[model samples]
Target: MHLTRTWTPPGAYDLPGSLAVLARGPYDPTFQVHAGSVWRTTRLRSGPATLRLTPAASRVRAEAWGAGAQEVLDGLPALLGEGDAPEEFVPRHRVVAESHRRHPGLRLTRTGRVLESLVPAILEQKITSIEAYRSWRHLVRKFGEPAPGPHPSLHVVPEPRTWVRIPSWEWHRANVDSKRSDAIVRAAGRSSRMEEAAAMALPAALARLQAIPGVGPWTAAEALQRSNGDPDAVTVGDLHLPRTVGYALTGERNTDDAGMLALLEPYRGQRHRAARLLTLTGLHPPRRRPRRQPGDITRL
Candidate 1:
């Protein structure tokens, strides 16, 4: 459906800003799009939208198209950023400020809740990205809703109830093992609690997620990275992050998680921000390993 909405000034500022940071697609699946399963593309759509401020004559207009547009746009500030942090949240302040300085048009977003972010993060565990994304596309398209507006081709994430009911055969088809699938099911069982965490303080939110089965430090951190924009919430058990960060910062080409943490010590609460910098600086260390191509699971 074609709809229209208006944002006076500050209210809508967070919406468009979020789209920029979360739209990197394949480069950052944790934030960009919500996955239903292993083989679908879901995007957030917006109604007729515009932004204007009282002090200036210039106006900015926006239009988000596709499925999940409302969910994403409505939930951006909640998932990708925070509006209530104190000025003394020094790490966040510095990170946001630095981000502003370096990327003037940058828009931080909140990715909604732990459930949506965590499911994919878990799927990504102990596997290559191609594996993770394939699993996501498969699961989502099989279970998710059609896009809400004019863009029926898009899909919204499956509801928690829907996630809890997925069949074992389907999971196997997507290359999802019982461990990750169980974790997703458990999280979905308490989906309401996860949604409640969005209104909580960062630490409290992290604690809530940890209480769920199979969601530990790494998964929580990954979820919070998008849902809360918490600069200090570093992924403790990521398979590839430590080496990537280490090589980018020290040129040593390898390091453990502890070493990566130590190297990022100066950034403290802004570890994610430091990582984002290393990512955008375009300084990837030369690859020493063979590249893996994606397997076509659909024909299996």
Candidate 2:
């Protein structure tokens, strides 16, 4: 069955920018940009669905197909960032203020599907983006079901049970190491509990996610940032975020996580938003060292 909905945002809205965070990479099977609309596939509580969002004059037109069509249609507002209060975010640094001013329509998106975010976040742990995105693309294209809709190429992410049952060789073929694979399996085993965290307070939700084996502050924060639209879920252990944030905020070339936090103290309740604004400014310290190469685990 097909379903449709149109939503008018309360203020300025950047449709593509809000949903861009959900795409694992440019070639993500579950997400695509066709024409001017955004096409995305997801496994809702009811079932799998494909959603197409098109920007109109002053609103968005949404269409969905499959068993979960109604659910996806119903959640379109939240998914497009109706739940996020971008106005509450006050940028203390000049760069942040400039980014916030330039991208007034920018809003954080909340998918409200914990496992969807968690699994990809797990795959990204301590790895280059190239490696992590390739693994995600390979695994999803192999295991995920074809999305329901006009777009034949889109695919819905696998269910939790399917995630648990993926064979070891398939994972290896996808270049997923055992450590990350094990974490995905473990998290999948408790998918119901993890999904429930989407409704809990941010701190409690983060704690619940981190409770899973091999999940840490970084992973939990990454998951919640999408699943919950958590404005303050600042990623703490990233390889480049601290340096970028420090340089944008203080012109410091060697700021660690602690220093980054200190610089962001003024934007306590919206630290992640501040970090995002800093990143949007394209301000980063000059690279003095070679970039980390993407690992080729299949050779090992």
Candidate 3:
């Protein structure tokens, strides 16, 4: 489809770096292939051009090509590195900036939609990430839109209505319990409101999401970590983060959320960024039990 209209970041949408940066998402073909969440394909066009991005109600459509491709791809880090931290947290701005510079592609990923991030974050609550990604992949393949364009394998996230309307049989099929399903449905019910939250500041956006029935600190932090590139919104209550952070900063294997926060306090607004760097720095606690074991409740 030819877009004749205009945008503030005109041509900015066509650039991969800018899109990846703005979205703080993964752009690697491998990631696109392995990650069921990424829906990508080339549009048959006459001449050379890079990608195009359109902000839909639930997805960002991207297309790209030619010489401009490199320019577009180069801008992602700079774009996503822009943080939404409050002025009060500005003291650590340099730290974040430096950290991003130190670890250019670290934890910054540009997932296509806010709800995509939100739903997974909710699914991960009090559970393993293996379980969360499993549930996400299962549900999307079952209920999501067949992504537009040639790559039929690409699937957009399930619409809020779809989540709210999912049958119990499908939930069992996906191994999602009532709690996770409930949170997803409840969040979906407020999707319209959450979409509006995108325009709000980080704190406000997180606050609105937190107002939902089941979205709590971990989920909100997870959402904002990408939604607004919020620096201060650390994912507390994580099972392994404390130990990871503790080991990275203090060379110890023990730390609670509070202690992790304290250890990361020096970075403040950029705590998440630092955590991202630490993780990317290969500083995780030494192979704690062969990563996390998956729990498939569907078997039970």
Q: Candidate 3 lDDT, tens digit per residue, 110-137? A: 3224565687778778877566667767
How well is each residue in 100-203 modelled by candidate 1, as lDDT tens digits?
A: 35544333446555567778877877777778877887677678755443333455567788899999888889888888899999998998888787667778
Descending-lDDT candidate ranking: 2, 1, 3
Candidate 2 scores a C-alpha RMSD against the true structure in Å of 0.8
How are the candidates ranked when ordered by TM-score, highest leading?
2, 1, 3
For every candidate structure, what is the RMSD over all alpha carbons to the true structure, in angstroms?
6.6, 0.8, 8.3
Pairing residues by index, what is the TM-score of model 2? 0.98
The model with the greater lDDT, 1 or 3, is 1
Top candidate on TM-score is 2
In angstroms, give how far residue 209 of model 3 lies from its true place. 1.3
lDDT of 1 at 268: 82
Q: Model 3 scores what on Cα lDDT? A: 0.58
